[model samples]
Target: MTSGIHHFTGITADVQANVDFYAGFLGFRLVKQTGGYADAEQLHLIYGDGLGSPGSLLTFLVWEAAGRGRTGIGQVSELGLAVAPGSMGDWLTRALTVGIPHEGPSREFGEPVLRLKDPDGLIVKLVGAEMATPAPLNGAPTRLRGVTLLTDRASETAGFVSRFGYTNSGNTGMTQRMISDTDILDIREVSGFVPSVAGAGVPDHVAFRARDVDAVRSMRLSLEGHGPTEVHDRKYFLSLYVRDPVGILMEYATDGPGMTVDEAPGELGRTLFLPPHEADRAEDLRAMLPQFALPGEERFPVRELPFVHRFNRPKEPDGTTLVLLHGTGGNEADLMPIARRIAPRSSLLGVRGRATEEGTNRWFCRLDATTFDRADIRSEAEAFAAFVEGAVTGYGLSADRLVFLGYSNGANFLAAFIQLHPGLVRRATLLRGMQALENPPAADLSDTDVLVISGRNDPYARDGTELADALRARGARVDFRALLTGHELTGTDVTEASEWITRTLSLN
Candidate 1:
């Protein structure tokens, strides 16, 4: 049977940044700096209380160039670590000294938690708890207090956890707390939030401790009906993974063949360690990895929404800049031609969506064909807005002359952003778009000029009209046109949109 949490695995944008925050700031020991078992090019790092103990371990798979993740339902929202009682003040002091932003030494479920975000935006909570012994390092966490899984399917997840020997400890508000002898799992029930996207700063998987390979195989058998399972030899430990009903990645791992298998106890984490399979290519892999260095006490400026983008300089440098956003499954260059056709003289900046769904890029997550993730929409909007601000400064473009060109999912994101930010975008051309939020933030769009084009037979056509009306009610100058078509972009739609862009730019 599975016991407590073995370790929580996450994805990070930078390995050195992760080490600086987890080991340098939090005082956790850097137990292992290794390459991923499956991918040799990716760096895998382990941080723990001491000697990389099972319950104390927190691992990260680092990719330096990956975008930020979307945190919502079907994901582990927060990771909790056990700390000695009365250590919250020390942790807060360390956080301030290290230039880490944190919130709350607040009480939750009878425990004090000092919450902070890691470099990649993963939630880390140091909870005050009665520990058996003091940690080796000052302010280092004792052990894993388990993870909080955010899901709409709370009952299903609770039932699934029960099969792994966890018992329901009842609810605190809308959260369901489950517990075993060594682990505490919190299931937060969320509704109308977007499904999670796997990216940098997201918890990749939560692992439960198993006795051995036999126990792992047996657990896999029990998880047959619940979800699909795949067993893999991780060299250090045997692992079995499954996606729960709500889509959170769960794993069962053995705690044998520990960190000392390759490096000696005294020399642990002093040098880069590679698995046997990857050892042959160590030289090549090392050359490809970014330089690892502990950041100084000064805070690093982390880009909120780093995107793959292309910036095109206009033939005549007009003060007006056209920002192009693509729909689902489209890349940064996907909307370039349309943007060029509509505003040839305007500077063109095309951005790719950060979130992915089954390898397809999407601006935000969706619950169903008709339902969108409201929380993710807001998060992506804020990030996108930040990205635009950065672009404006980088390109020496005026914010007042900015115009947004978005289609379908991209258009929906613009609608959400304009509602949240009000006058950030002076003008926008939304193609086949609809409202993303049921109760959008009330803002004054009186100075905004918007052109909304909708397909008559599109499923969200009504939503498109409603959004236009909503904007108009907020005093925006909205020109809405409905064409006799479906969800796809039409030639007539483009022609009309081009005309609208020309007229809007002229008036401005």
Candidate 2:
């Protein structure tokens, strides 16, 4: 029977940073990039050895713009990677050069270990050990050494783990060591510890190896009274999940139908693959998911701009650019999918807001639920103007062909900008917008064209007409529409927005 860890999965908010650390810095090969098995909307990435070996695999569930999580009891708080013995100096030097947060060269459990924190603050311990196929001193980890589980009910968990072929080796302090055929398991018991909160940086589950379908079935049968999950066919493997006595998630996965089953070994991770069921929505999903450039590819450097921004250039460009500004609590990539559908051939530049309200992102400060901060609005608009000017020059984008698209709070900001700075924007679209200024000086907006869309059922729907009136009074061409909907966006918005853009841009 197969033993040891098949893989470990974790949650990460920043996919680019995660890939940079694991694949670029640590030298792991990106084995697969696919949509999540359970949710096709989010992405799932796998990193492993050169051959995409199961024992060396580490997978991640991408939750963009998610809040940070707490690592506490009932979680795998630390992931152990086996490295060649006496490689601490090399590892430390690499970490310093790459700006990876690290601690230790400290000895733990009679082995030299170097602790490095990933961008999301997940603990990765590189333990110096002599492996069967010894990894180079400055190379990718040979395989997973083990994982450190934080459990309050350690004795029960230990007994549960033994069914997967692990045997109690020894104990040091409150930590009991369990040895498997290919790796180690360290259960550190701490009473009265806080339970873990699920979000970014938390290890979701630890999967153990099963020889085949029969082995997985046998294991599932053994877990009858332990609340075992129904078997899930994950394309690459058949797996089942269960929560141990301490509430830590564990899985049993078949080793065959491996990583190379779908894609060739040489072409693995080169293309984004969706689950068979979601293949029909592949185009939409591609636009929604965050775009990333692997290491050594020609990529845009995220510069020190006035606003946090992200750029997505299509494979083929039609010489137009869309400047996207998201609503409150949203990030730079929030409106990517909508914008993509509106103008598939246009380049997208999504910018994050500088102001924050109640720990959530916003274009400008809010005095109250309905009141606006005038001074903050003016200041941010000026800064936003500067950011746009810089982006036009730096990104080699045409200033004359730029189109601004904003939603809600972002829409308000754009409306304010059009009033505060005349003729700055050539074309714009506002969704659920309002008149940002109480009273504004009339500016020459004859060179601009604006579209104002509002939901009739929305509380703020009346304000949309006010914004359209303000733009019209300033000599801008304004098209106003009220859809029969609520504050939340609907398919009607996409249809209207896309048709309007196609007509305005004359894109056949």
Candidate 3:
């Protein structure tokens, strides 16, 4: 039967540095050096035990020039490697000798754990376990012990994973530990930390073992009752990906057609390998990809703040532009259609929220459903304001004609950003958004035009009025409406928003 983690895949900035850390320092074998199956331009490298075992494999999709990612909510915060009991001393000595920055020889759930950060700031924990495989490197880590999933909704995530056969083992402080027959999982509820961003040094997805193709198919059917599930043929395995209640990306993958299927055992990772599907376009893909070579002991400079965004120029270019921001869990492309429907001729700039909860994107971290982290809100707002400034200048668009259109969390972030940089946006449409700042910023926004649309029956209905009053108090012209619907945007909401945009633009 499918057992524990088949592999944990993450993004890396420099493939050479990654090789140096995992293969050179830690002494894990490079099982397969290949190109990305889906995106052939990126490098896909795998590190594992002597044979590239399922539970031992750590995989990375390297984008050499990519910027450093922010670690936040809605992401796998830590990857735990299981080491033989009493081997913590040896591992600690190795880390110190190599100058690896680390913390904690602390004990959690009665297990000894040493935590450290990789070159790109991804957390790696060496966990002491009796059940781990015999280490190949000085009796240190043998296989992946488990993964730590950080989320806001811990109870919901715990319940969901339990439904899929994980049993609650125990809890250490705020972390809930779960055990499957073949693997261990930990869930930590984090509030107030910055939400995670996707880029280099972020664990993108975690895959569980499935017995075979039929087991993977069955798991997909079971997961549908909870949320969305997508099945893909990975060539080496058949897999299904799903997001839990709080947004952690979980994959159930079949165990057959192992890593050695394509290459010979002895020469597994010696040369570049491609999936069968991409074999035809290998030459073309190689031309586009950046050339790589083994590391020579020097570290590369880390680029900061990887922001995911999309800018679209209108076919019939209007002087005005719409900056679209989507709700929590929505991507940059999510609000493009809405922008087009409202302002067809206007250029569009859609920004993906950087903070993630589990796998869902959020503008900032929340203390709970109602309370927000004001500090994080302020930090992200500053970053977003800079991003907007760059976009306006780069796209050759007038800052005066740019209108901000945001929904829910996106709208809340806009509320915070506008308060700090009031003149940056002259007009904005906030849909079902609330005041994100704990203590509102004092700004003279006399000439600014704002429209806030909310559902009367929504839980955050009061936030709409609070935000409108706050804006009005600061001398801005605020138009507030509370429709007869719930939290969702209805046809009436869109119609009203379109009218408001027209009236506001015409006046300007």
**Which digits, one per residue and each the tens of the lDDT, describe model 2 over residues 403-508?**
9999998999999998898877978999998888987877999888898999888876555788898899989989998998878888888888878877776632
* C-alpha TM-scores of all predictions: 0.59, 0.87, 0.57
Any runs in candidate 1 off by more than 4 Å, and if so which?
133-135, 294-508
Report every candidate's CA lDDT.
0.80, 0.87, 0.79
Q: Write the per-residue lDDT of candidate 1 for residues 1-508, one digit (tens) a residue.
A: 5588889999997766788888777778887887778786677888876677777889998866588989989988899988887878988898888777799999988999999999998989898886542235566777888799999989998988776678998899989999887879999999889988889988988888888989988888887777578998886788898888888888888988777777787777777776677766665454334445553533323343467565555437677778888899986656766676676677677788988889998999988877888889888888877887787776667877788999988888888889998778889999988888889767899889999999888875545788899888888999999888888887787698789878887785
- Summarize candidate 3's per-residue lDDT along 1-508 as a digit string, tens digits: 5467888988887666788788877778788877787776667898887767778889998876467887778888799998876888888888899899999799988889999888887899998886555325454368888999888888888887775468889887889998887778899989776778888888997888888888977777776667678888877778888988877888887776877788777766777776678877665444334334444433323223335665555546678888888998986656766676677677666777888788788999987877888888888888887787777666567876789999998998998888988888899999998887777878999988999998888875545899898889998899999898888878787788889888888875
The model with the greatest TM-score is: 2
If ranked by TM-score, best first, what sequence of candidates would result? 2, 1, 3
Which residue pairs of candidate 3 clash?
72-195, 72-196, 73-356, 74-357, 74-358, 247-359
Misplaced by over 4 Å in model 2 are 132-138, 228-230, 304-309, 327-334, 352-396, 454-465, 480-508
Best by lDDT: 2
- For residue 49, give model 1's deviation from the true position in Å: 2.0
The 10 consecutive residues of candidate 3 with the worst lDDT sum are 297-306
Residue 364 CA displacement from its true place in model 3, Å: 33
| Residue pair clashes in candidate 2 | none
